[model samples]
Target: MTITPQWKDELRARITLSSVIMRTDKLTKAGREWKGCCPFHDEKTPSFYVNDQKQFYHCFGCGAHGDVISWMTEQRGLSFIDAIKELAAEAGMEVPAPDPVAAKRAEKRAELIDVTTEAQDWFVEQLRGSAGREALAYLNRRGLKPETLREFGFGYSPESKQALPTALPRFEDHMLVEAGMRIRTDDGTTYDRFRGRVMLPIQDARGRVIAFGGRILENRDGVAKYLNSPDTPLFDKGRTLYNLHRASPASRQTGRVVVVEGYMDVVALAQAGIKDAVAPLGTALTEMQLEMLWRMVEVPVLCFDGDAAGQRAAMRAISRALPMLAPMRSLSIVRLPSGMDPDDLINDRGVGAMEKLLAEPKSLLDTLWEFERDAMPLESPEAKAGLKKRLMEHVDTIGDPDIQSLYRRDLLDRFSAFAYPPRQQAKRGPWRGPAAAPKTLSNGARSTLQKSMSGGQRSDLLGAVIAGLVRHPGEISRHSEALIELARHDQSAAPAIESLIELAETLDSRIQTAISAEQGFPAPPVDNRYAFLREGTPPGEAREELAEAVSLLAHKPALEAAMAATIARFDEDPEGSFAEQARLRQQLMTVDERLKAFGRKKAGSDTARDENSVSSDS
Candidate 1:
């Protein structure tokens, strides 16, 4: 018999998600993580674990685990369709069958809504009880308020082995197992999920409880210091960022999101009246988290702990966040005082102090620029030359000329002492010509080159082709053979061509995947022209100088001699000026490469000519 939609809704409403979790009693908290039994499998010890920051659940023991939906499916023997319907119905809505696609989407959304409401209720109930009172006391000591608590959905998990189970009795043992609340033995018995712990509910962007972080009151060596939900359909640890829902609005208002390292940090921010703050539960900041933060505000503040590891982590975040940057979006690295977290800073120095720091937060480029100035000896010519080269490489990557100019000025100011010649001593010994030396440009050639290459797209179509071929060698073998064959003939295209050829040879799936794009291949910004042109440019040698001049002319003809004079000069002085002759030859090579690339297109048109010739012969 087909179950009516109303019946499913009524049945789901009756199922308490918290009760299901409490039925197993596997979860217990330490400082932050939640430890529990693998509900999907029978195990002696609790191995299923959840980290709110990571937003995922994994069972180190039996390995029977997934996100919330996966857990529900595994434990309840429900198909993905039925499970979504069941969860949606619990949220108190009639399942709308708008269309197959819409129906499926609504079911998924409804399940999340249902699960979120149930978890929120459980958390709120916990905060109202005795154990919740203890948690409240802890928050009070940290200077938090009740209204603040309510706004952030502060909830308490009562300190009872059976309280949650009693509240959610209709929930089946298998459902409880799926929710990361409890585990079952071979005999199929169940108990409380998080015993004797104050719970911190983890919510998604829509403020739904996809997971929980339970804090254990007592110090137990063997027990994990904290407990988290297992990977459920609703959450993935790598993807879940704590306090993002609340922080998003605040970030929108303030134009920044302060990213901390824990749930407590979020509370501290909220308590300090700085609601636009968030943290990852337990894992390192991820690319996905960066993307999420980018969507919310123009700048995301990375507030790392003041220790060495935290600084290292901040650097990593900077590195990851930089590539995702758009024109307006930026990331700032906020280094708290040593031995202090955002929570500690708020508690000791006040939120205003943190805000002040946030206001003047350091940019990654600024930090690296400072580091370069301090680390390098600019006074020496060799040091200055090396510094200029490295700095140019960095400046070349920055698409924004304004930001690049700012960095350039900062670099000059920092290395001013090193960039000039030593002041001559006065004729008399006592006083020198001047205390400071006059500053000079470190390396003019490199600077000029950087300026020249900065004007156009850096994207490499050939590189894109190579990347695609690596990912799908068969695809390259099918369509790009002509292009590859042409590249093989020309020295300039050889590097890009060989890369694709290598991929074709290896036939690696990963390379193929990386190359796959829905639209045309992605070109690096026009500013990246330097990367391609730099290698081809000639150096000090006769042949190298010749090649460099040719490239310069191809890219910027104003720099080269007229075509007729250059050819005549080369012919007459082939014996006299080896360098000039070589340069001319190099120019010819560049022209040849461009023609070949051009010819590939022209060859297609030539096909019509060949066909006409065949018709005439017939």
Candidate 2:
């Protein structure tokens, strides 16, 4: 369930902040508060303080601060809900479960558990009894070892329609139907839903037999081969994985999870000793399923069958998962050999071959490119145009703007590399140098540029950036929009920004040439902070640094503006605002560090470091 501000407030109110901190850290009474060495960072003396009265903790040494939820997510590395659940348990409070009807369904689901558990035991008994002889043989012929079968709790359902209803006489017919084991016809007739199949229990994260999947042992032309429990109080196939109960823990150690197309594929990988594999239950991966995968590992490997259906399934997952994509969280696809599934490959070439394939799966971008590139022949302009259109269509589905832009660039680059043949570079005419433009600016021009570069919080960066752009007039047009934004937001930098724009297009270079190199210009930054300002720097490096600097100048004002807006929202949405504020601060901090990038580059050299903080000079 979504965490609301009121719920967060209640959660914080229920738990004594100091007690939670004291569970893992040592704290001593310090007036109304408790103090200890910061758990977030190392220190000999206590700098971290916890106030149960205020329901927050703060570390003075490293600027770490947050309440109970933050402590779990930030310090302990638990996910947000995981943190809340743990705290809710400790405080004797019930956390709102992820399911919307969880509170109402909780009791019903618990009872349904017994039905599934009973069904599971009966199925196992039948598997080992006379009724399961054919199913057991099928399992054997499929190369399933006795131990593997037991490990995954493989069982069988008898062909008789009254098999389950009669076997579990204690459970009512309606209970079995509701638990997804019995089908009720409109005419009041009821029968088994999974007749004549081998049964494998579908479990929750805690290993409860919440649902079941069955594979048909008999081959009837009109019959389906595989079946899963319908959506019930205890299970939702779209939100559940076949082997998550076992795979989640294993994936922690492996730092990876392999998602295959079927439960048998998951079992096959497990039998081969690759225990961190799971599968969606007879469907394409859903958004909820992808989120579940992300919680286990940053990037899960998707291994689908080698047939056209398999590739199509992989693409369906990609399309569904694109919008949910976040930084560092996406899928890697393993395309099996033609006509081979994971089980077939492991049996044919060995686990090492499967492992090799897993070890070098195609990246999401690579998979998308290859699939579309091969979808139709790119032999004509229209065909190739469709390829480009499709690539962007996939990219446009991504939610994060930064990730979206990056995907667009990378995919388009790939498209250009693939669809268009490269040509030899045309020879250029010999270059001729013009005499350095007159080292004198007209009085009217000098006054305007000087006034524009006068002052602001970003004055130092803006002034310096404008100077760099003038020196490299050829580069100004490239970053014109951002420079215009900088001028719009920081009025003090407007005149210099306008002149730089003109210098790139309409105005003569001599005007800027004199202003930058001669006297009476915006005074040169004392440190010559940017690469563009440094003598003997590479032209490419200088241009790149100037672009980054201008971007920072354009964005710094907007970033601070957002932070202020977050602060303004604090009273209305403290939890949300605080979380948003932290994230925005992180972004601002990144920009701050980037502002000092030239300094970092100089750290490797035998010179003074670039100490360029966003200057407040006027």
Q: What TM-score, computed on C-alpha atoms, does each candidate reach?
A: 0.47, 0.65
* Per-residue C-alpha lDDT of model 1 across residues 1-618, encoded as one tens digit per residue: 233545443544455443445454557774566777665445677787765544356767533334443344434434445565666665655554567776686576565545446756877876687547777776676676878777767666665656655666666556556666665668877666677666777887656677788777666988876777777656788898998777765664565688887887788778778888888877788888876676555467888888878877776676566445533357888888999988788778887899899889898777656555655566667887787677666555555543455456556645565576469865543221124452222244223222222332132333333332333334444333344434434455544444444434433322322222221222222211222122333222322322232232233231134333644663344222222322333344344455445345346546765887899999
The CA lDDT of each predicted structure is 0.57, 0.78
RMSD for each model, in Å, please? 24.6, 8.1
Clash count of each predicted structure: 56, 2
Tens-digit lDDT string for candidate 2 (1-618): 667778889989988888877887899999999999987545798999998988889877655678888776555545566677889897788776666566567778878899999999999999999999999999999999999999999999988998887788998999999999999999999999998999999998768899999998867798888889999988999999988879876875576899999999999999999999999998889888987787666678999888999999999999998898754467899989999998899999999999999999899988998999999998999999999999999998999775687688778868998888688989644322234553444555555555544443246566667667656656676677777766776776776777666545543432323234333344434234467877667787887788778777777666677778988987676556655555554455556667666456545432444223323231
In candidate 1, position 152 carries an lDDT of: 68
Count clashing pairs, candidate 2.
2
Return the top candidate by TM-score.
Answer: 2
Q: Can you give the lDDT of residue 172 in candidate 2?
A: 92
- Superposed Cα deviation of residue 71, candidate 1 (Å): 37
Q: Alpha carbon lDDT of residue 467, candidate 1?
A: 33
